[model samples]
Target: MFDEMLHWPFFDERHRALRALGDWADSALDDLVAQEHAGGDVYALTPQFVARLGEAGWLRLAASLDGRLDARSICLARDMLARRSGLGEFAFAMQGLGSAAITLFGTPDQRERYLRGVMDGTRIAAFALSEEGAGSNPGEMEMAARRDGDAYVLNGEKTWISNADLAHQYVVFARTGEADGARGLSAFVVEADAPGLSVIERIPVIAPHPLGTLRFDECRVPASAMIGAPGDGFRIAMSVLDVFRSSVGASAVGLARRALDEALKRAAARRIGGRALADYQMTQDKIADMATAIEASALLVYRAAWVKDTTGARTSREAAMAKLFATEQAQGVIDRAVQLFGGLGVTVGMPVESLYREIRALRIYEGTTEVQKLIIASGLLAAASHGN
Candidate 1:
């Protein structure tokens, strides 16, 4: 798979090893699909998928060999899994995202409790940041975390939370006080079994990833559950997003490549007007454009991953650029692939159609394309004015 494209320059031997692991995923995807079909239980299937990944030691690729959460590893894992199956990628991505706060800022005790589960896939992880009223505006979150004796009582509703009903724990965000917008907020690690916490509703999307609303009604936890410090949730969330957003882009690249591969195979075999579809210049142009876009998106996505891994930089701007460009370009490539496939593209269960739906959410999640643009422009302007 790595040799099939020109976007590999950003990767190293470690990344190649991870890419090779995709062979196991490709071989086993049929079994996974069959099981999901027989059971129709995303919650159960997802955990098993994670466990399988962990048992193969592929879940360890979500972090680093030394146990640090390396950004490049996360990117490569997402890319490979996404190429094989969207659910596979979603399952891998959430483990890292749900546990990122702990990996980055947790105390030794916190890491031992959370990171172990994440690495071993014994526990599923989740990030609960988006509220109905505060989807894009963090300052608008109404969920309040009030101090009560030695514990913090969390009261808020978080909707569209990934792995909502399935996750064993969540890194939840809530406002501690109203000192300032986006400043009074704090992050906490809350157990799924925590009192007053419940899965209010399950939201189904075109893809089969798990999502739902979580209600924290006087949900209380020890102060030790707080990540970083009170009034620091906004910073922590942004820092975590910076690391994972690029991987979202990389996933998009993988999906786009799968679409392109399907298109190429179909075009080479299908005969139209007494000739193969490949004989037509129009078909050739579409293939060329799709291939170019795929490579370009992959480069941008992995470049961001590489920058974050090597320099340990904040990478907000680079990640935003990657997510923004790669997602947009990937959508275009998928659209072209569907066009190339003609009638077969829109057919249900076809790889291109599946990818079309799968790629749409990546643009919205992790930070929307518009949000990424604003981030990039704001950073550019700030850098220009500061001359640093």
Candidate 2:
């Protein structure tokens, strides 16, 4: 179903190769959910899964030497992975999200030390930004890093962190200056074994992964551990999000595509009044709506990714638009698929039911639907104010 979309002018030879690679990578993940659950601890299984992705060299696409991320490739990889396994998508995305700051802003030494391990699958990476009081508004983060001689002592907590205890290193954001709001923040590379760092709690959400709360009690890291200069944390965080946000939309598109496929199969096989479900006008209408939304979402997602790859400009507005439409529409599309499946849709262990759980968090994470709307509105207002 997604093959035709790859032929669109928005994609190129490299994008096609990435899609092919993703397909190959995903073929082995058929039992990822079961494998994860087999250990009786889904979070504990994340490191092994990430290692597999790294060993396959699929993680190389997530990082680049020139400090430029290929949004199109990332979107393709995420879309393909999401279609097959949510855990696969999560592992791939965390690799990118966790290491994006280092790729974009790390010093040569930092890159050499971390990037190699991250790409090789020997080491896991994570991004630590949200706090107890800060989610949508990261500017209110209370995690503070106080400079002490040759090191910075980190003292606070980060919650809802993916790959929390499993990551080898974390791109930790903390307040470093007296300036109010986000201006005071800075980014740091905190090793997992750092003296004061500990996983205080594990959090289980609708979709399971390695999520937990991290406590930094006077966790001292060398000043050399900082990703960029002081007060650059907010900038780095946004920059990373700007690159990855559209890919989140692409993932949603993939999940929706899978849902639609399942619905079509169900509709074709299930009979109503001695006729196929697909023969019914209402069923046709639902299928039409699902296909239309998926196509529109693909366009928006790929357009945003293309702009970022070609123009090298901040894609705040475009990314927001793509993420907003794709995630919201995916929920609707999946819901329709559930309806089509009737009782089986709501039943445990069904593909559509699993998708229902997986797609819900995409809207809440990365950035919420409400946050995307605000971003789009703010962009429009700013453009109007500038008379552009």
Task: Say which candidate scores most in TM-score.
Answer: 2
In candidate 1, how many clashes are counted? Answer: 0
Report lDDT (CA) for all predictions. Answer: 0.86, 0.90
Clashes of each: 0, 0
Q: Kindly list the per-residue Cα lDDT of model 2 for residues 1-388, writing each as its tens digit.
A: 5889989999888788776665576566555657753433666566767787888888898875567678999999899888877887888899899999999999989988988898888888999999889989999999999999999999999999999989999999999985889999999999999999999998988777779999999899999999999999999999999989999999999999999999999999999899999999999999999999999999999999999989988899999999999999999999999999999999877889989999999998888999999999999999999998
Which runs of model 2 end up more than 4 angstroms from their true locations?
33-40
* Residue 293, model 2: Cα distance from true site in angstroms: 0.7
Question: Which pairs of residues collide in model 2?
Answer: none
The residue-by-residue lDDT of candidate 1 on 203-264, one tens digit each, is 98877789999999889999999999889899999889988999999899888878888988
Instruction: Provide TM-scores for the models.
Output: 0.95, 0.97
Q: Return the TM-score for candidate 2, rounded to 2 decimals.
A: 0.97
Which residue window of length 10 is worst by lDDT in model 1?
Answer: 61-70
